[model samples]
Target: MSLLLLVDDPARPDVVGLRSLSDDGTLLDSSEVPTDALPAVARERADRPRWVWDDTARRYPPLLAAGVRVERCHDLRLCHAILRRSVYTQSSALAQAPPGPWDGPRDPAPVEGSLFDDVGPAAVADPLEELQLQLAAVAGSDEPGRLRLLLAAESTGALIAAEMHHGGMPWSVETHDALLTDLLGPRRKGGRPAKLEALADEVRTALGQPALNLDSQPDLLRGLRSAGCDVESTRTWEIKALEHPVRDPLLAYKKLSRLLSANGWAWMEAWVHDGRFRPEYVPGGVVTGRWATSGGGALQLPASIRGAVRADPGWKLVVADAAQLEPRVLAAMSGDGAMAAAGRQADLYQGVVDAGIVETRSEAKYAMLGAIYGATTGPSAVLMPRLTTAYPRAVALVEAAARAGERGDVVSTWLGRTSPRPDAAWQAELAAASAEGAGADDVRAARRRGRDWGRFTRNFVVQGTAAEWALCWMAALRRRLLAVDGRPHLVFFLHDEVMVHSPAAVAESVAVAVHESAVEAGRLLFGETPVDFALDVVVADSYDQAK
Candidate 1:
């Protein structure tokens, strides 16, 4: 008979086809082994039997063949190691090994460091901590039910601030201080000519009382001006001044002749209370490394809100915007002659059409945009072929990059911000499929999946480059705002807009700063690549009024 060697774990409940050694050390199948002796093999107490191949028998040998392999000896440590590596490598099948002898102890944790070691605790109050405190205070109040409503209001205000800041205003302590001073108004050196005194003659003439003194009505006029209602207007001011108060609640109508006109004071008081003069911010709001607002519509500030964003006494707000950012970034990345040429000219989409890439400019625009953005469905997919034919270099570059991504490699932004790679399971699946039969549909599908991964990889480069441009723009604008000695502080930011609270005096200068910053940001990002970033800016007393 041929000698057969078998290595099996009796302790394993799934052990089948296993045999035992007889009393004289002769191997026998489970059927031939005595039933009472089964416990010895099953309990793994008896010495495990091993079969050796007998070459002279001229029959099937059972020792490990040329390629066939199995563990020759029981090694709990080695088995656990194999299992761990299999798990780490994300192998399709688990290691054919037994469990560890016992559960392992916990790993040691890393030590924590103080914030001062990194950013220095001497820095300004932590924005996150401040926000947490504010939130806690609001949440812990007697009216806890109002927390959501309060948060919503706060978020709206933050959005407004972000939009305003995005306009290209600088956010700094000095600018904020200056803006606060302007909003509060400057103190007069000498006793200023009271508004009542200035309008004393007009009041007397309109009221038909030549000798009437109106020294007590200056607050009313100041309040009217603060509400944005012109105190000198004839329709509201003069007409109202002429009407005498028929009854005075405090005087019980006994001094109707002495009572002054309420005029627009009531409306002004209400306006001041309702209008947003200042908004709050929550700096670290976005999970994807972006800022978020706690108050104000930072993401969607209305033009009317700009009217409420007045600058400080002598400072002004500046704003800027980046132009055709992503397309230019794509042109640089792909090095597509047609795309480069399109970018060189004013309109990139038109250039693609002019190059005969597409029948119409709209199609060219959509296709080009979709290509850079990794769009693969519907209309975007339909236009891909034309794009590929027209700019093979660009197509190939992104396609190759995407392939790399599918292979579980990390993709980098233009500035070297690398995306996290796919996990081990993904790598194992791709690797395993790559080794499978050629021409098989499964293999083809795996290759296609890899290509799809590459597309994502390619788009990341362009998108990341665009994001860098935005950051550069923000940084440049921040620097420019700092250069202006006393301008409106940047109180908000959106993707491409900035908002500043500044005085009317420096509004024009702030706008200029914003424009210059955009040009500078472009130069810094692309290094004089005939591309330009232009902005449209408007300045007013309030956020709503800015255009």
Candidate 2:
């Protein structure tokens, strides 16, 4: 594909600059065009050039709003971040270069109008230079092929995020309001809901403190202690362990309180607009490579209000989530054919039971999670050895990652997303543990911190690889959907699940495409790997009814 580098002039809001780059990233030509004519310029191009822009959120939304979608693009900021920290590209000029304008977050608010009108703070990073550096970094990397694949998938993910924002999550105001009313009892202008107030009263009476402030943790804890209850904190789980009489009402209060605060009437009023929830998704937001949303709580939408995610008339929501994604990725990464076989015929846990690795599915789950998460106590720890003994290849991979992390070394995911070095505080703890004057307490603390970080890296490798798989899945699924009729498009994406809004007539075909795309994604990541990325596909009018 040809390359078009977009250059926005902050000083002149009416026109924007564009440059064409050669295959080797050499600038071939430059031109300026009217800002409002961008859509026509893009639409008239027979080449359908891959857009090279400083930030996707800033540049892509307006084109999408104008009804023009590009097939591919290189996102400078996202790729720069990857190459800057990536171990594979450390020797390249890009990684060795000092921190510059591209080192921080891109402007938070995306440009929804003329791109130049919202051009932020006089573009400090030159797109042409940045693209040259990124290309050089990838070409010189240890695993050029893997890094290229990763960069492409990462860029595609950015486009998807922008597209999803433009095409917002389907939301129903009536259903949302009704759910709030049914659960919390009526909206209030400046007061708590009736049910919540009733619960608070019950809590106060049970605690024997009429003036208790349940909202304040210290106040609630002091009130509990004052009422002759032995409580350390106001955490619901800790409260659940208490045998005191106030336990029931207090737990109920906390549960209802969370519902009221997170997805309450106020939240709905702010997030839901024009029958859609348009969250600003921050792609590659988490270090482990999972996505995070900057707004609308897209990742943390609680079950209580999912009913509001209803399909529009003549359309259906196609929801599909992978089953045991991390473990499946782990098996493929480790080349553990036995572990893969265990999940071949049934749910992975049930397959583990049938294979006699563990007596029950619960034990299988705990043991598998423990192995991946570095669990050192409780049932997970106790069951881990048996699992390790049965699945040596898989367990060894994570165990090796843990040991590497304990030594403060960086570990990479299957596709080479390297972890950061241990922080200064962690280094200090290690030094203190080994210094001549170190005491038993110092050594014990260091040991604990080492294990904690070890657990993090152990999970990071599998989890990060799983995230890569998911991005690949969405990229593949998006391509498949683009070919289908009725404009099936992805509207919501959690870590391992995707929700597509499609015309009701093509919902079944969309589901099939979803399954095919999962297979394609698995192939793209681990070619011909036997591990299954099985999905639970559903077609529903409302998200809450999918399960």
What TM-score fits each model? 0.44, 0.96
lDDT agreement of model 2 with the native: 0.88
Give a tens-digit lDDT track for model 1, residues 1-547: 2212223334543442333433222455543233334334334533433222111111111111222121112112212221222212222122222222211211111112200111212222222222233334333443333332322222222223333323332223333233323432222334322332334444444444555433435643443344343446323324344324311211221121121122112212332332233233332133111344333334544332234444444555444444456776666666565667766556666767777778898887788777776777878789999888877877777766676787777565543334445557667667778774645776777677777777767776666566556555555565565566553456556656666555666667778877777677566655665554546576754344455
Could you tell me how far off, in angstroms, the CA of residue 405 lies in candidate 1 after the best superposition? 1.4
What are the lDDT scores of the predictions, listed in order?
0.45, 0.88
Pick the lDDT winner: 2
Off by over 4 Å in 2: 109-123
